[model samples]
Target: MDFSLQQIWEHTGLFARFIIFTLGFMSMSSLIVIAERMVVFRKTRSDSRNFASKMGAILAKGDLSTAANTNLGKDVGHLGRVINSGLTAYRISPNDKDVAVESVARALERQAQREVQSMKRGLGVLATVGSTAPFVGLLGTTMGIVNAFQEMAKSGAGGLATISAGIAEALITTAFGLLVAIPAVMAYNFLQGWVDARSVDISESSNEFLDVVARNLTGGETRSQQQAG
Candidate 1:
């Protein structure tokens, strides 16, 4: 058996060819998704950090309007959007502390859900490829073993040379499948971790923003009561 690339391709059976083609497609798709996600996460992380710094300064100065308008005409990330949502809600019901707090809380929750969905996009495909690629490879290996036995039976000889070619060709698909699967699995885990960490940041920021809104609202209500008294 020559066992070269040309020889393997030429000797590959129809089933083996189909399996290899499928694995190749999966690998390519996963790579594309990984690249796209990397870019998206990077941009969001950068934007969020910038938004956080500006937002901290604005909040420290008690400028709710500026915080609300910070991302109005500009591109912002998940944290910015969430903060804007809460501020917008507060603006809409400025006088009623209870209404403002409730509105901001609801807005934060809704924005969090949307951000999570955006972060989780394409993760399903990676998970599917990681979990199933190995089984697909195993199927190819089994098909190759059957092919080896068939060749032996037809030749009426159990010699190594008689069945080795079929066995080798069959094993090629399995090897290729594993090659596709390992990276997909590792990438899936890495991206999942990134998403989780970002989710935590969004949560913490939302909580802090809510506390600020609550305190301001409570103080305003107390001052109004004191003036009335």
Candidate 2:
């Protein structure tokens, strides 16, 4: 069959429309996931930046009361949650130096893990869409080609133009699928990296905070004993 590329582009077929619709849905889903991830990453990144500053101020000032005050808030990031947990532990057992630090560190670890997981939410869907979209598009194209050949079989001497519509639809769908998949895959991977980095930051910050708390309490003990003597 004789088929010109121009003729294929000009015509729409069943395969083309099906592929177009499928690709459209996939693209829309990917966009939604991207938007969600962007919001999460932005918030997490901001939190990580502020956390160190706030923590440094708390350690330098040696004011547990003010530190507690500073750490208290609903909008604070993962680091905030960890710090707060530690602070809470200290408040609960101010005398038991080991227990206070351990309790808070353990609790914060759990909370940090949870927050990291939350940030990663919906990424799996994006990955799935990206990985599978191309094959789906190819399937549509294959079906279109099959239909075109069927038509050629019946027509005996069918020209390319005769099946041009089907073939075009197939190819267009495949292109659309790839277009949707690539960005989704890229976004998913990028977001994953951001999540990993933030998780590390939270862990490190929490550990440093515990160290500061231990040092502060030890210094306080030494000074108190000397004063009493």
Candidate 3:
């Protein structure tokens, strides 16, 4: 018995159709997230690089005030925000070296956490779709097999023709599930890697900024103590 795609779709039972619809929805959602994240990640990377280059020269001159103010600008990214937090803390309590260092460290940590959280938005959905889509499809397959057996029982004829429709539905739904799941899993991995790389860059930049602040603060303290002596 030959069956066309249209014939198979028309014959697909309610449960199998529902599973296919669910898979379609998941795929669409994953695609949306992938597109949105790609744009955001690209812009963040570009902005961070620009911010780092501009601030690097300023920090070399021991200009904490300028560095702190740069973060408020529209062009700054995560690295700038982290650096701004620490610099703002230091500027507020320049003479209290211990307090300033502690404050800046805390600020950097907080900002890093916030940035990571922001980057992780929508990833949970992707992960859920990647992990559960196959199982959902499998459920459809199970339902299809049951339906095929039921049809065989009803017809009283033991032949492939009696069960072909159910089998086709089962295969179609399973294929659709894999189609949705494979791309979703690949996208999740790629986006996760991008997030990790961005995080590393932010961490390294924060550390460099902290080192510059520490040196300037320590030098100022040394000069003050020598003057007192």
Candidate 4:
């Protein structure tokens, strides 16, 4: 069997060709998701770094009022969005320290979850491709083998050599399936790891932000009482 991919492809039946095309589409979908997620993560990380640098000083000073309702000037990233949510909550709530602090805490928690979920967008597609591609290819191979046997029976031939070419063509889909699956699984794992790392970062930042908000609110109330006294 002097078989190249092109030769095998040319000889493949309609169903085998359809399976190949399906696998090809799956491969493309996974690649597109991986690339899109990579770009989004990179851009968002850059924006986060910039936001932290610009806002860190004010936040560290526990000047919640100063940082509240800040103008982002552009689409902000994860840290920016979470922090802004807390600040907006703080600013909008009434002057009760406990109530305001509680509001900010809740806002931070919700926004952090939202950011993590946003970061995780498109990962489902990667996971689906990784898990399903092999099965899809297997389906193609099974169908191909069944067809191959039918052909042999029709021709009244009985031997492995007689059906070798058909079997080889059928196995090609399995090979292609493996090829598509391996990279998708690897990419999914890699991107999932990145999301986990960012989740940790968000958790830490949210904690720190809550601490700052609580202290600032408490201090403001104490000062107001002292001045009144």
In terms of lDDT, the best-performing candidate is 4
Residues 104-173, candidate 3, lDDT per residue (tens digit)?
Answer: 8888889999999899999888999999998889999989999999989988888887888788889888
Clashes by residue pair, model 3: none
Q: Estimate each model's TM-score.
A: 0.95, 0.84, 0.95, 0.96
Error (Å) of candidate 1 at residue 159 is 2.3
Q: Candidate 1 on 1-229: residue-level lDDT in tens?
A: 6989799889989998999989999999899999999999999888888888878998987667677666634557888888888888888875877878898999999999899899999999999998888889889889988989998998899888898888898888888889999999999999999999989998999899999888887887898999999
Best by TM-score: 4
- After TM-score superposition, the amount by which residue 18's alpha carbon in candidate 3 deviates from its true location, in angstroms, is 1.1
Candidate 3 least-lDDT 10 residues: 67-76
- After superposition, the stretches of candidate 1 with alpha carbons farther than 4 Å from their true spots are none
- Show where candidate 2 strays beyond 4 Å: 1-11, 220-229
- In TM-score terms, candidate 1 sits at 0.95
Q: How do the residues 93-120 of candidate 4 rate in per-residue lDDT, one tens digit apiece? A: 8899888888988999999999899988
Q: How high is the lDDT of residue 76 in model 4?
A: 69
Error at 34, model 3, angstroms = 0.5
The TM-score that candidate 4 achieves is 0.96
